[model samples]
Target: MTRAHGEVGDPPVGKYEEPATPEAAADRVEDVLKLLEGRWKLMILFQLFGGRVVRFSEFERAIPGISQKMLAQQLRQLERDGLVHRVVYAEVPPRVEYRLTAWGQSLCPALDGLLRWAATRGAPAEGVSDS
Candidate 1:
C-alpha cells in the first residue's frame, strides 16, 4: 500500500512536477497561491498557526483592517479549499472557532521562512509587519 503523505496526496516521499515552462511554473504556483491568495487568508492562517482556535470576530480583530464581509468570504474560501476547519459549539451563544487543517498547519514552517525572507527584503507583504 502506498502511504499518503498529507493533504496533497503525494506518496510518503516524492517529487512534484508540472509543465516545465516559466508560464506553467507560474501557473502552478498561482494555483497553490489561490489556496492562500485572499487578502485575509494568509493572515487568518497565521493567526491560527499557534494552535489557537479563534472566533470570527477574533479573526477580524487580529487582522486589523479587514472588513467582516471580506473576513467571511476569505474564511469560506479557506474552508472550501480544505485548509481551515470551523468548529461550532452547541451553546446559548452558539460559539464558532476557526483553526488550521493539517495541510494548513504544514505550511507554518514554509510561511515562517517566507516571512523571514520578506522581512530582509525592502517591501514586506501587507498584513505582515516589519516589527
Candidate 2:
C-alpha cells in the first residue's frame, strides 16, 4: 500500500532515525515542517494538543476564518501523518471527533521547545534591523 510521501509499505510510524550529517538532519527537520505547511494546520494542531478531543463543529467555532472544507482537509492530512485520531459515533446525526494519537502527543515538548526558541530571539542580530 502507498503511504504518505509516496513510500510503499514504510511502516515505521513515529520512529526517529537519526540523520547521518548535520545537513541531513536539517533536511529531515524541514521535511517535517513541510507536513505542517498550511495556515490552519498549526492552529488545528495546537487545539489537538493537551489531550483535547474536539468535534468538527467545535473546530469550526474555535478556529475562526477557516472554512469547513479546509478544516476537513487539514484533519485528514494530520490523520494520514499519524498525528490525529478520528472517531465516529453512530448517533442520530453521526458524531465525529478528533484527538491526538500517542505519537502526536509526543510533539508537545518539541513544539514547546520551538516556542521557547522563538521567544528567546530577544532582538535582531548585530547587522539586522527590525525596520
Candidate 3:
C-alpha cells in the first residue's frame, strides 16, 4: 500500500530517520509537549487559527478569565517557539498584532481533528461552558 507523505507507514528519506531507540522517540515527544505545556497556549493558538491578525487587547477581551499580564507572557512564549509571529508597527500608539506562522498553521489539522473527536464524544469544545 502507498503511504501518504507523513503517514506512519511512509518511508523516511533524506534528513529524516527513525529514532535510534524508543527512549529517543519519547524524548522528542516530551520536548514538543513541553513547548505546548500551558493552559493558555492552545487556546491562544485556536484563536489565531481564525486567519486574522489579533492584537493584545483583542485577546484579553476574547478569552474570558485571562489577565493582561498572562496574555502577554503566553504570546511571548508562542513567538519564541516560532509558532506565532508578532508584527509591531511604528506609530505613536505602537500598534502590534499577532498571527500564526507557517509552522503554526501546520497544527490546524491536528487541532481540528481533536475538536471533531470531542464533539462526537459529546464533550464540550473549547470556549464552551458545561454550565
Candidate 4:
C-alpha cells in the first residue's frame, strides 16, 4: 500500500527524520521535556484546550496563586514555542487574548492520557514519596 504526504498513515518527510541512535532518541525526548519543563506551561495549555480564548486577567483568575509577572513570562515562552497564539486587538483600552495553536491542540490527547494516569496513580509507589 502507498500513502500520500500528510496523510494519516504517511511517514514524516523533510526535516522530520527519526533519530539514528538511542542517544539521539534520548536527546530528542530531552528536548521536548525541556520545552515543557515548567510548572505552568501544561496548566496554561490545559486552560486553552477547550477552544475558549482567554484574556490575561481571565488567566490570572483561572490560575490561582500565579503572579502577573510569572504568567506573562510563561505565556511569552509558550508563544515563542508556537504552542499558543496571542492576539491583540486595538480598542479603547487595548484587548489581548490567548488561544492554543494547531500544534498546541495536537497535544490534547497526550495531556488527557497524562491526566488519566495521574488520576489512577494518586499515591506514590513503594519507594516513592512526595518531595
Q: Residue 98, candidate 1: how far off, in angstroms?
A: 0.7
Model 4 segments more than 4 A misplaced: 1-15, 118-131
Off by over 4 Å in 3: 1-15, 116-131
Best by lDDT: 2
Q: Report every candidate's CA lDDT.
A: 0.76, 0.81, 0.78, 0.78
Give the distance in Å from residue 5's predicted Cα in candidate 3 to where it truly belongs. 34
Any idea what lDDT model 1 has?
0.76
Candidate 3 has its poorest 10 consecutive residues by lDDT at 3-12
Q: Estimate, for each residue in 6-93, the C-alpha lDDT of model 4 and write its tens digit.
A: 2112212357779999999999889877767788988898899978799999999999989999999888887777677777776758
Task: Report the lDDT tens digits of candidate 3 across residue range 2-121.
Answer: 221121121123675788999999997798777788889998998999687898888988999998888988888888777888877767687778888777877899789878777778
After best superposition, candidate 3 residue 41: deviation in angstroms? 0.6
Write the residue-wise lDDT of candidate 1 on 58-117 in tens digits.
Answer: 887678999988898888777777777777676767777777778778889989998889
Q: Model 4, residue 37: displacement in angstroms? A: 1.7
Q: Name the lDDT of candidate 4.
A: 0.78
Cα RMSD (angstroms) for every candidate in the order listed: 9.0, 6.2, 11.9, 9.5
- Tens digits of per-residue lDDT, candidate 2, 51-97, equal 99999999999999999999998888888877788777767787888
- The Cα error of candidate 2 at residue 52, in Å, is 0.6
